[model samples]
Target: MKRGKKYVEAAKAIDRGTLYDVAEAVSLVKKTAVAKFDETIEAHIRTGCDGRHADQQIRGAVVLPHGTGKKVRILVFAKDAKADEAKAAGADYVGGEELIPKIQNENWFEFDVVVATPDMMGVVGRLGRVLGPKGLMPNPKAGTVTMDVTKAIQDIKAGKIEYRLDKTNIIHVPVGKASFTEEQLTDNFQTLIDAINKARPSAVKGQFLKSVTLTSTMGPGVKINPIKVM
Candidate 1:
């Protein structure tokens, strides 16, 4: 793969062999984001837990102290009072089964997150094939499926993010934007790290967090020292 000039320049700033502390990593990530637009800073965590084993699955949500710089658009599946509540709580799009065709046939996916009421899961189930692959399917564990749509919408709008182990046992989540102050990015990164640490599965053996890397969308990854993270 041919590397871009900006990427090559940014890569020069990071020492691939060195593991940096969280604060240093965050600073480096910001400095290396040479994109014209505000680049998103993301944390890629490689864990020892195997996602294939049900017991080893690691998944949960957390509210970043400084919300992700990107605005989150929420699509809520609810009916009657719950639907009204969701709209009242600031959900971007609120509807019930009617959205199925709009999404399936029209291929509309304007929202960033999907929030569904418990009763609407049956309705949501119909669109699982479409939503699941996009990681837009609302799960109860992520607080996206709940009777309390108000809290769910509020949390998401306020920077609530779900972190789950992918097929490779790596969890990727956006911490903040490169434009954010170093302190703001560090605070969000620490909050997310604490949440992941607390969600450690009991079935995991040694070194739950095998590796952690912080990087901007277009920057070379800045490795975070796992020992310092703990």
Candidate 2:
């Protein structure tokens, strides 16, 4: 768990006890990105909900206003017209069960996102044991499992990202890159926060957002004021 010198230097810039405003946090994240390569900016939101409870689970997707800077490769699980639609909409790869072997035997996973048509879920189910753990398994709640292959592919290509609470109820997502303007990063951050707020489950009685932190790929986390975000 030894951090590099660059990371240690960057960590010194942030006040460990302070909760920064969204804009300030975004700016601090950009400033602390000392890596030679344009590092990706990520948001980590700790929520009060417990993922073990079905009713408290938080899972959904949102189209970042200033899309995630990384290019998203989409793998569509479809057949016939739907498959064609997916390709026409700029899907990186489109196929049905035939892909199972390529993925299983060859260990091929070139795509960043997985989209499957509702009818094709049966075929997709076979790969669940592999895809589920990787967070590649498409679900209806995330709009990855749907009949609208074209829309799904387009959205993903347009910087749409899915966010869901992990085992500890923290949702980690890429907001943008360090190369982006502070304004762009702020916009994407706000959009994501708004979406998460709207998705709050009625079952949660205490604070919905426990803590929100923004940081670059190799930088120290800058905590955001949860009250300000809410």
Residue lDDT tens for model 1, 1-230: 89999999989989999999988898899989999999999999999998999999988999998899889999999999998999899999999888999999999999999999999999999999999999999998999999999999999989999999999999999999999999999999999999999999999999989999998888899999997886
Candidate 2 whole-model C-alpha lDDT, 0 to 1: 0.93
Q: List the residue pairs that clash in candidate 1.
A: none
Highest TM-score against the true fold, candidate: 1
Least accurate 10 contiguous residues by lDDT in model 2: 150-159
Candidate 2 lands at a TM-score of 0.98
lDDT for each residue of candidate 2 in 1-230, tens digit (9 for 90 to 100)? 99999999889889999999998899899999999999999999999998899999999999998889888889999999999999899998999999999998898999999999989999999998888989999999999999998888878878899999999899999999999999999999999999999999999989999999998988999999999999
